[model samples]
Target: MSLFLTLKVALRALIRNKVRSILTMLGIIIGIAAVIAVVAVGQGATVMIQEQISSMGDNILMIFPGSASSGGLHFGAGTRSTLTPQDAEAIMNECLYVKAVSPMVRAGGQVIYQDKNWSTSVNGVSPSYLEVRNWELKEGAFFTDSEVKAASKVCVIGATVAKELFDTESPVEKTIRIRNMPFKIIGVLVKKGSAAFGQDQDDTIIAPWSSVSRFLQRGSFNSVNQLLVSATSIKTIELAKTDITSILRQRHKLSEGTDDDFSIIDTAEITKAITATATTMTMLLAIIASISLLVGGIGIMNIMLVSVTERTREIGLRMAVGARSKDILLQFLVEAMVLAGIGGVFGIIIGGSTAEIVARYNDWPVLVSAQSTVIAFLFSAAVGIFFGFFPAWRASRLNPIEALRYE
Candidate 1:
């Protein structure tokens, strides 16, 4: 029989048992849907992480005061009190690959705006802090170099702080008291919701580092909490790191092989680590989903075997007439593939809808790429062929006389 006739016969056979055909395709549909949904969620999560990290800065690297291990003892960030504003200035003046540097001094206090007061973090930093962090102002302007030089009590409030303290009022040109010292609110930072690790991105205030170090911080006058550094560009990140390491070590007079007093957190490295973790999770889920696809293929094979037995006399009559063995094999194979293909189509629709619903409800993202969809459909078809082959071959090899004589 011709290819068209084989397809017509196979489809007719499937239509004759619609319920059974649908039941057999269930495993495949469930498996494909699970895989697609998993992949879409994973991709969306990775993108969100990247966006959060990118919001932190352009070629950003944070310099904390101490390493995980320092002086043969455990020391976490800001514990050593080794970094100073002078060191940040040195990096800015000496490192060619460094684009911007902001020495940060952190303090916690209640900010009082009229009758309303909100407890929030206050950061002392230079005007360049916004540039290094790639943050923008929603209103007014950042403090000037003269304000930083003079340790002036001028400030920029984050979106959270503004909302809590001033509500709908634009915070610009307003005054708020921090630790009993009044600070003029010069700008309101644009809202940045949260980090990948769930830290609130905008719940603080920015002021001159000089002011924070002079009046707010309790310890050494010269020391800063951290240094926010930005490389000239992404391509120069490693070179900037090397330059920073060498300059800081020489200034601190560290010996060879000794761990440096400072710790550098590379935003790019953090991105890679997070994305790798997401990809691993996605792959594991896909593997688990594939088990259903295997079970579906097995069901198809079992059903085909039963079909061959039940239609043995029909098969015998076809062969006795003029149908070739290859024709008989193709007909059965087409039926299995068509069954699987239809399941795959349905699976794609359900998977996409599931992903969409999840994203909508959770305020998350979902990316159902075209490449993943095509691969899933093709894989289902391949599963059908591999499982259907044995039954098709068995039916094609049966002796016509024996098949005809069988009850």
Candidate 2:
């Protein structure tokens, strides 16, 4: 028999038991849908993480005070205030690969405007802080070097703070009290959603380091909490780190074999760590989802076996009428493929819709690629062939006399 006639016969056979055929394809449909949806969600999460990491800064490095040891016990990083504003200036002036540097002093207090009060972090930094952090002003300008030197009570509010305090009104030129001291709002930072660690990026306030040290917190004027360093380019980040470390060691006068009093955090390293974690999670989820496909293949094999047993006498009739065994095998194989192929097509449609619905409901990112869809369809077809072969071969090899004589 020709391929077309075989397919028509196989299709007719399936149509005769419509409910059974549909039930048999249910497993394939569910399996393919699940795999596609899981993959799409995983890919979306990975992309979202990468974007968050990139938004932190371009070729940035953070320098923090190293841990201090006392009584054989060691404190964590940032426990000491060994970093200073002078160190930041020296890095910009001496480090050839360094593009910009900012000294940071951190404090926390309630910000009061009119009758509303919101507690938030108050960071003391110079004008270069914005440049190093790749932050932009939404309403006003940053404080100048002279203002930082004079310990002026001028500040920049982030989007979250502005919204909390002023609502729809602009916060520039407004007076807000931090730590019971009034500060004139000089600028408002553009909105930055959130950090990679889930911290709210737009929930703090920025001011001169001198002001924060003098009025907001009781600390030495020369001491700073951290330094934000921007490299000339991504290619120069490592070189910049090396140069900064050497310069700081010399400035701090640390001898050989002595532990330095500072720690450097490269944005590239953070990005790599985050990407690695996301990739691992995606693969894990994909692997778990794949098990459903295997289960579905087993379902196909079981159903095909029942189909062969039910149609034993029909097979005997065909073989007795000169129909070749290979023809019988081909017809059954094509029927299985047709079932799987149709299920796959429907599964893709359902999966894409499911992914979109999930993304919308959860406000998450989802990407459905053409490549994944094609792979899923091809895999389904392969599963059908592998699982259906045994039952098909059994049907072809049946003894015609015994089949005809059976009740």
Candidate 3:
């Protein structure tokens, strides 16, 4: 028989049992839908995470003061002030892979302007801080190196600080008081919503390290709280770390057996860890959903076996009338594929709509890429072929005389 006649015969057979065919496709429909929705949400979340990481910095690394052990009591990292502004300068000047460096000290107090008061963090940092953090100014210029060297009482504020203190007024050239000392605002930073840890990114102020150390900090020692560094390139991040470790160790005069008094955290490594977690979750959900598709394929095989038994005399009649076994095989296989293909199409539509509904109501991100859609459809078709083959083979092997004798 011709291919077209075979298809026509297959369709006719399925049409005779429309309800059963539809029921058999249910598992595939649900499975495909689940896979699509899960993948879409996962991809969207990954993209959002990447954006957040980029906003944090480009090729950035954070160095914190090492832990302190006193009287057998050990405190974790950032508990002791072991770093200094001079160490940051040494790294910037001597490290080959380092692109930028900023030494930082932190203080927090209520910032007051006129009658308005807002509590926020005040950070002391060098001019290179803007580059190391990939921060941008909303208005006005950053404080110059000359101002930093002079320990000038000048500062820049974050977007949250600007809104709470200045309202509609531009913060440039204004003055805000922290710790009973006034500092002129030289710039306003662009808004960054939040950090991965859920801290408000825009609720802080920036000032030169010299000015902050002199006016804000009440410490007897010249120690810094943190160091922010940017590598020359992403590929050179490890090299930058090596150079920094070597420079810091040599400057501190540490012996070969002595432990270093600092910790370095690579933001890129954190990004990879987060993205990998998302990918793993997506794959896990997809695998669970695929189980239903497998079950649906089994349903098709069981139904096709029953179909062969019901049409035993018809099979004998066709075979006796010159219908080739291959033709019989093709008809049954096509019927099975048609069922699965139609189910897959419906599944895709339902899945996409469900994702859109979730995104619209919950304000969540969901992306249904063409690659995923095509993959889901192809997998459904493959399931049909794999399950349909056994029943088709059994039908083709029927003895014509014996089948005719079957009641």
Candidate lDDT values, in order: 0.88, 0.88, 0.88
Alpha-carbon runs more than 4 Å astray in model 2: 1-12, 94-97, 232-236, 310-330, 395-407
Count of backbone clashes, every candidate in sequence: 1, 0, 0
Q: List the residue pairs that clash in candidate 3.
A: none
How well does each candidate superpose onto the true structure, as a TM-score?
Answer: 0.93, 0.87, 0.91
Question: How well does candidate 3 score on lDDT at residue 159?
Answer: 96
Error of 1 at 370 (Å): 1.1
Put down candidate 3 lDDT per residue, 154-174, tens digits, no spaces. Answer: 999999999999999999998
RMSD for each of the candidates: 2.2, 3.1, 2.4
Q: How would the candidate models be sorted by lDDT, starting from the highest?
A: 2, 1, 3
Off by over 4 Å in 1: 1-5, 67-73
In candidate 1, which residue pairs clash? Answer: 125-209
Cα error, residue 312 of model 1, in Å, equals: 2.3
Q: Rank the candidates by TM-score, best first.
A: 1, 3, 2
